[model samples]
Structures are given as structure tokens and as C-alpha cells.
Target: MRAAVFVFKRFCGSSFRLQNRGVCDVAVVGGGIVGLSSARELIIRHPNLSFTLLEKENELALHQSGHNSGVIHSGIYYTPGSLKAQLCVKGASLAYKYCDDKGIPYKRCGKLIVAVEREEISRLKALYERGLQNNVKDLSLIDARGIREREPYCRGIMALDSPYTGIVDWCLVALTYAKDFQNAGGSIVTGFEASDISMATESPAGEPEGLKYPVIIRNTKGEEVRCRYVLTCGGLYSDRLSAISGCSTEPRIVPFRGDYLVLKPEKSYLIKGNIYPVPDPRFPFLGVHFTPRIDGSVWLGPNAVLAFKREGYNLFDFNAKDFTDALLFRGLQKLVLKNLLYGISEMYRGVFLGAQVKILQKYIPELGRSDIMRGPSGVRAQALDSGGNLVDDFVFDGGVGELGGRVLHVRNAPSPAATSSLAIAEMIADELEVRFNL
Candidate 1:
């Protein structure tokens, strides 16, 4: 074991030496931060348990987790006592500590939620109160002058100074988790795409039912491998995966692409910290704002525009089927009609970069069209309900007694999910333990 470890270390650094030491007691599908974090927690809690993490991509955090704004949210925006609030607060603290200990770059840069108009003041105050209830300490209400004091060029009627907010490179964090999971005798297989999941229960005698799924996944090379106890964190395709598991719940995933603009280095000083708008009570997303990344580059944006495809990254990208489904879906129709004005405004702002610049200049008067560079975008996999309302919380549905009843399917996990990754993992691991009696 020592010689093998040494040889492995000589080839691949001591941190990520093991790539395929073989399968284990657990198989985590998806190599995003959430899956990697879950794998790390599972191995740490039960060292005796062997684990395997399968990712369809060549590297982890390649999608939403990596594309995010890198903000270490302070649990300020979420409703108090909700899962988002609870998990975000806990996750933020744990993330900072973990990053610090692991030598990963991070900053408690704090944040400012600004109300630019008189009408936004009430919502700003409500968010402030909610932050307090969520135990976000040191939330100070800052008037326009106060905002200018912190961010000299900023504009706003009032703002909330949340010192608990911060930023970190999520890609780095996910890589660290991969390294740790591998070092702890866990297997991480990249380019392994899970095709289907079969479900069944574990008998009292510890025998897996014949209906039990041995997850069939094809590697990048098209080689198929089977595994027991498949736990999926498939992000955008979660609902589809659940359908494959024979679950009746048909929650449609609507993709909302958030476009960003990174302020040129010269204009980066416009924000002393994170600057946000008082979110509309009707919507879950906190409108576009300034986020000072840990790397010192400031970014503005994330206009929620409907994407024609699930994984559409480019402006011109589209899928005929995806667009047709979205247009036909009752929830999508209702969402558009209910927020027609806001939706129209968002769409107009998205196409005309000059319009977006005006919105930015509301806070940073110095920003010009040339100062904004095209930054990366992230797609939110928002789940729509039968009632045509957007599902706000994380949604999970396991086929109870359907596939002999052993599969737990997570249909929706968005937003603070990246923040609540560790806690979410604990939840997944606990449920799996009971299901498999391991």
C-alpha cells in the first residue's frame, strides 16, 4: 500500500494521486461542486466506506458551479428560517474556514444591497430584517451618503452593509474537494455519463432486491460501468433523470441564462464590495449588481433571460425542441404573463448593451460601454410547478415503492445550493444510509 501510494504520488501530486483505484461503496453522479463536496463529506464521516464519483465532463465544476459569480452569499437575500437561509449561513461559514485551511483563495469582501429608488426602500428594509432573523450579524443600514463613503462613486437611496458576505473562486474550491476525496481513498472518474438509474430496496437480510439498479454509465471512451447506490446531483438534467427512474412527478426545468459584464480593471474600483439591488418580492433572483471577485476583478450583470436550450452558453445557441417545450409549458406562459413588464424590460436590456450600461451607471456613473467586457454566464435550472408558479425551495422526490422503492431523486436545487452544498450532502448521505442500511 505504501509503495503504491508513493508511485501514485510520484505520477500525480500527493493531493490528487489516485484517479482510478477502483469502485467503492458509494457512487456520486455528477462532478460539480455539490457532488464533489458530498463525496468528501461521505468519505470523511465513514472512512471505511469506499466511494466513486462519476463526472461526464473532463473536469469538475465545468458548468453552473464554475460559471457562478463566485459570491459567498451571507444568507441575506433568502427568507428567514427557510432552507436557503439556513443552509447558506452554515455553508458560508464552513466554506470560508475550509478554504482558509486548505490555502484556497477567498475574501470576506462583504456586500451592499442598495435601493436606488424611494419605492425600493421598503423591500430593502425587509431584506435587512430577514438578514437579522437569519442570524447575519453586523447588517448596517446605509443611506446614500453612507454608500458613497464606502463606495465613493456609488448611487442609491439606501443600502444594507452585510459584512458576512464574501467571494471565492468556486472552481478552485471544487478542485480542492476532488483532491481531498481522492487522497482519502475515493475514486473520481471523469467523462462518465450516467444513462439510467434502476431502483429497488435493500432487504432486512442486507440483500439488494433484483429490481435494484446497477447504474449504467458510459465513459468518455464509451465503456459501460455499473454501480450500486447511485446518488445523482445532475443539476439541469435532474428532472429528466428522475423521469428515467420512473417517477411520476413531471417537473419541467426552465433555463434562465444570466449574462455578465466584467468591468475593465480601471473601472473595478467603482465597487468597494458587492453591490446589489433590492430584489422584487415576486421574483426569487436578486437583480443585477456589482460583485467584486476574490481575484480583484469586479463584475456586473446576470439578467435573467429565457435560454432556448438547457446548456446554451452562446448568444446564438438554441434548440428547437427546448424552445417549443418552453413556449408550450403552462408555467412558462403564466410566468411571462404575470411578469410581462419586467420580462419585456429584461429582454430589452439583454439585447441592447447600451441599455444595460445605463442600468449599471445608476450605481457607477463612470462606467461606459467600452468599460464593460463580456464575462461568463450561468444558467439557472429553475423548476416550474403544475400551478405555473416557480418552485422556490429545493425539491426532491424518491419513487416510494415504485422501483421496489430505493431510489431518492432530487428534482431541483438552485441558487444558494452552491452555498449549501455541504449541508445538502449531509442530507443526501443520511437518506442513502437509511435506504441502503449501510
Candidate 2:
């Protein structure tokens, strides 16, 4: 039955045609949280606008949105005045409100960023200051005693407590967004894999005279959809999708696989809430940390390692095209060289059980090898530029080639993206409003 459904969906996705069916005001690609949220935002702002959302997969949130740690970031780690900071801080409140209104389950359990070494205290202080500057409310600098009070088994010289940090089932949140979008007269099509985008030489009738191009979106199954405008929230394949739409190729998406270890049920009591390490300033990834899920499970040690495939969740998973892309990218070569030692350590932890446990022991000394088994893993789409620098903030690009102003692409959205989906959608919607003169 599953095989039949998969085959039928694939056939429909490839053969489906919307060219004669009707024209839509807008089309949204990617059915993750961001895409759904963007569609919902568009509907809310312009209730009568005709819009459709396309998901390549059979269901929504099957990728990054569903595989995350479910931690609701408090915007403490991002730099002040950056898009991440602004969106995350606002997005958390919006997320909570939406969840409450929708009757979705979530937890307001706070988080702790622990500094085990004396040298980390200064860095911790800096993070605290940044959090304050970002207007992260209820943030406090805590000493070792305070850490114990909040998380008894955790040990550190000092820590930063973010009471606003919480957790939720992001997949559920995304589904709710989809429901609201549908309620507002938006259409969602699953299994529609967008393969390329091109501009129509002439604008469709009734479109403004100045609107030079109506966008044509083609999917893998030879189906096509014509719309006045398109928005892409293509998480892992964002860069490729943008390139297909005639956007620049300077910043490419690099996949990093984050593998976690779940604590044995009997030992889950050793930690409460989220416990994190003071992140290394040089890199964007937050190191391995402990996260308590809404399902009452505690997860640890999601060390980032280069993934051979963009969606490769398993260590052995490989794709010839994805692997060659990463290997041929000059930026990735330089990035690996610069972080050689750190990359080696992460790889080692992934292979060796003891190495992974040792890193976790820095915070919870009682955690041993037997206390944790393998847990779920996720792949992050880290965008890298030609200079080998990681793109630290949200990247949105459009208005290029002959399709200028007819398309918008979300090129880079990583961690906190799930947390900031709604806010990001609003930002994208605002940009579209001005660009398209809607």
C-alpha cells in the first residue's frame, strides 16, 4: 500500500499541469514550517489573493522542521542587530501565542548555557550581554550554585539562564500553520517537486502592463504551474532552487549532519530542561548539548560533521551528486582546512562512543556510556560563501535575470529558523508587498 501510494504521488507530481487549470497570484515552494508560515502570512495579509503551496514530499515537515531538537531558542546566541536576533526574539513570542490559540502542546522549560572552564566565564558574560542587547527577557547570569538549583546534575563555573527558552513539536506547529493557510482559501499540493523556473516572455492577461514576466514553475514530473510570483523556502535545496530561478551561485548550501544520543529512560532524570555549552565564537554551530523533548526524552551530543549528501541522516548515506558538489566547492575546502582539528574531533565523537560520553561528562559527571544509546539525527543546511565564510544571518535574494521581481528565494535559514518561521514570513511578505507593489 505504501509503495502504491508513493508511486501514484510521484506520477501525479510529475504529470500534474496547472497551466490551463487557472493562474494563481502566488506559488510557495517547500512545505516545511517556513513555507507553510509564509503561505499563512500571505493569506492573513491579503485574504482574497489566490495562492498555492507545493511540497515535493508526500507530507510536510519531514525534513529539518520535524527532525530538530524542538528547542525554542531565546535569541541569546545571535549577534545584536542581526536578522537572526531580531526575528528570533519576536518569533518566540509569536510562536507561543499561535500555539496557545491553536491548542498545540508546548513547554516553557528554560535553558542553561554552562561554562565548565574558567576561560569560558568571560565568553559566557559576553553572551549574556548580547542576549540583553537582543532584548531577551528574563535572562540572568548564574554561578555554579544557580546551575545546580536549576539542573541539579549539571556542573559549571558559571552559566547563562534563559527562562524564555522552551520546547515544542515543531512538526505539529507547521501542520497548524498549514491548516490555517487552507482555512484562508490557500491550496496545498504535496509531492509536487519543483524542478526549474523560467520567465514567460509576455505577462498573462489582466496582469499590470509593467509586469514584464509571469513566472513558469516546472516540476520533476513534467508538470507546470504558472503564477504572477513565486516564493521559495527550499531548506536543504534552497541554493539549487534559487540557481534554477536565475539567482547567483556564490553562496552554496553545505549540509552538516548532527547526530544525537538519547539518555536511557532510567537515567533521564539526570538532567532537566536544556543544557548547552558556551559555543565557540569562530563557528556558527552550537556544540553538543542536552535537550529535553516534549515527549519526556532527554537527548545529548549532536556533534556537527560534514554530510556527504544534503539530506544524509545516516553516517553511511551517500549521494554522488551531493557528494561531488561539496567536494568541488572551493569554499568547503577552505572551511574544512580552517576547522581541521574541530572537524576531526566531531568525526571522532560520531565514531567512538566513549569520546561522545566524555564530552557530555564535562557538564554531567554522572553520565556514563551505559546511560545513553543512539538517538535521532538531523541535517542542517549551512550556507557558505566563496570566501569560505559561513553565512551567519538569514539570506533572501530575488529580482534577478529576466524574471526580475517575479520571484523571491530564501537562500539560507538554519537553526532558529523553525522558531522564527512566522516572523521570517512577515519579513518576506513585507518585501513582496513593496517589490510587487501588491
Candidate 3:
């Protein structure tokens, strides 16, 4: 065990190469797509500035960015004037351009929002209008025949077609971003878990107080790095990391596990593109849907259930602290009470394969329990407010108190986050440039 521990420490130490006197212009916490993109954007905009990116895991995109459904959303479901709608619409184009420039493979396969029942058609129409309002191009409301033309096996009274929707391997995209950041002279240090952030008072002689490096970040290994500014894109632990930097904790992260079912090889042909249901507006989570991955397999489901741990991917995975945090939160309690039926139904589908197949059969009448095998799962970092309302849009909170004007935190960025990563990075960079005169 001692030998193993020694080897582990040596390996991690080699990756970081931390210097006792090392400093940077910026330190980005979190190595997900957003962090990588942010780092890339910073280096591109300010060619001479230095940056350090910290990640707890040895590799990047092992969490939400890796586990997502890989759907390039077309700005359909978000509120018209919200950040999600704006960023997602812009991000889709940016993502495609990035993919083309990087030679990353992607497809503009289009998507169908199917309304199987009469009640859903009205809601579907409302969504179509919302999409139009959000400036989603090539969006059209279609009848049953139109749905047939788009997705032959999909059963629906009506549907909305988004031709701009597409798919790409997001993990690959994130890796490419990491490579670009490194190529631009930004340092990426994995296995460095940022434990606390404090203000650094020391400044170089004759430096203005406002220009001094004010943020000190300490990792679990007791290593310290000082920076003039900090941007945290911590996905699952955003709240904790923000609070460590003297930011408000009114909205806390709650982990929700979304499990998918991969169709059998023969059954993969059932979905040509993406098929989705009209989502409940009260919550941000889109309902169970059919997604065709770039790898030529169809994925169904992603039923949302409270996860016992932030990174829990298996059914029985548990963590006492994570479980207790969700259970004891007043916001979770209120959210559960308000959406009791929906929550119970989602949990049911999570547990029973038949229940999930039933939901999928609403769109693909041919799907049976035997047609699918258990596939991968991802945990969403859902943010809930103290008042029990689930945050429904992209949320960014700049630090306050001691860390004021020096730190920025992304409190909630789920679903379309991977798609909006580059555009989101641009927004963060713009904010930092204006605030710090970068």
C-alpha cells in the first residue's frame, strides 16, 4: 500500500510540476468542456497571458461532458430571451464551425419533437412558436404524414422538425479543446483538486492595488497557485466551490442520475435522428427521448432520479454525505412535494426496463424490452434554490465579499451546456475583460 501510494503521488506530481513560486494571470477550476473552452478562449484573446487549469480527475471529460447524449440542440426548448436560447443558437453554429476546422466528425441529421396525444399537440405548437421566437432556423410544424416522412416509425399526431439539430462526440470535442489550450501555452494540471480559495495580499513593488494578484487557490495536496482572476466552471460541485470563494450558496447542486438504454444492433435503425417529447415547462429536464449517437447506435431514456452521490452512475452507488445533503435540503423537499407524481414516475422508469420501454414505445411502436440493453448513465448537476424552485436557465454568479470581482462561478449549466461551451466561454471572457480590464 505504501509503494502504491508513493507511485500515485509521483505520477500526479509529474503531471503538475508545481513550482513554489509559480503564478499565473488566470486559474480555471474544472476541466470539463466549459473550462477547456474558457481556457482556449482566454489564450486566443490575450496571447501573452498565462493560465492554469485544474482538474481532480487524471483525465478530462470523465463526468457530465463525457456522459451526455451528444445531441447538438437547436435552441428549441429554452425560454425565448434567456441565455440558453441565445447561447445555444449561437453555439450550434460555432460548434459546427469548430468541428469543421478541427476535422471532428459531426452530422446535421435533424430532430423531431413528436406529440403522440392530442393534448401534447398544443404544447408542441407552443414549443414551435418558442423555437421561432428564439430564431431557430428551418423549424416547421408538421402533421402525422410529415412526421412519417421524417421518421417513418415514429408515431405522433403532430411534430416539430428542426433540421439544424445534429450530433457529435462531445468528449472528443473537449479533448480537442484541451489540446488547443495546451498548444497555446496554457497549463493543464490533472489530479489537482482545488480545496479552498483565499485572497492573496502580496503584490509586486509599485503595482497598483487593483492590478495585484488577489486570488490564492490551494489544492488538496497543499500546493498553492496565485492568480489575478479565477473562473470556476465546476459542474457538479459549483455550489461548494463558489461558497469556498465567498459566493452565495442560496442555490445548491442536486445530483440526478440519467440512465440510458442502448438499442440492440438490429434495433439501432429505428431512430434515424432524434425523437423527443414535449417537456414539462416547470422543470428544465427534457423528457425521455430517442437519440441516435454518432457511433451509429440509438439511445433511449435518461430518466432522472436522485443520485446518492454526485458522480454515482450505477444503480446501487451511494455516498452518505451526498445522500444526506439532498435529503436535508429544504429546496429538494419542496421540489419533491411539488412534483411528486412526476418524480415517482421517473424513478419507476429508472428501476424497471419495461417501464422505460413503454415510454419509448410511445414514439417507436416497435420497441420492445428485448430490443434494448442497459447502457451508460450520466449524473446531472441540477441546481435548486432555497425557495424550492429548480433553476431553469443558465446561471452565472460572480464572487462576493473577500473574493469579490476576482472570481466567477457557473452555478447551473446542464443539458445544452456541452453544446454551448464555446459560446459560453466567449461570454465569460467578455465579462472578465470588462471587469478586470484584461
- Model 3 bad stretches (over 4 Å): 1-21, 201-212, 282-284
Give the winner by lDDT. Answer: 2
Clashes of each: 0, 1, 0
lDDT at 399, model 1:
49
Per-residue alpha-carbon lDDT of candidate 3 for residues 1-438, written as tens digits (9 for 90 to 100): 010111112211122232223468899999899998999999999989889888888777779988899989999888899998999999999999999999999999999998888888788989999999999989999999999899888888999999999999998898889878878888877777899998866664555666467688888877777788898989999999988977777689999999999999997778898999888676547889998999898888889999999999998999999999999999999989988888998988887899999888999999889999999999999999977887877777887776777888878886699889899999989988987788
lDDT score for candidate 3 against the true structure:
0.85
Worst 10 residues of 1 by lDDT: 1-10
Clashing pairs in 1: none
Q: Which residue runs does candidate 2 get wrong by more than 4 Å?
A: 1-22, 201-213
| lDDT per residue (tens digit) for residues 196-238 in model 1 | 6653233223335543334443443545444556677788877
On lDDT, the stronger of 1 and 3 is 3
Model 2, 1-438: lDDT tens digits are 011122211211222222123357899999899999999999999987889888888777888998899988889988899999999999999999998998888999999999999998899999999999999989999888999999999999999999899999998888778778877888777777999898876665676864433678888877777788999999999999998877888689999999999999999899888999999887657798999999899999799999988889999999999999999999999999889989998999998979999989999999999999999899999999977899988888995776777888989886799999989999999988988787
lDDT for every model? 0.76, 0.87, 0.85
Model 2 poorest 10 in a row by lDDT: 1-10
Error at 327, model 3, angstroms: 1.0
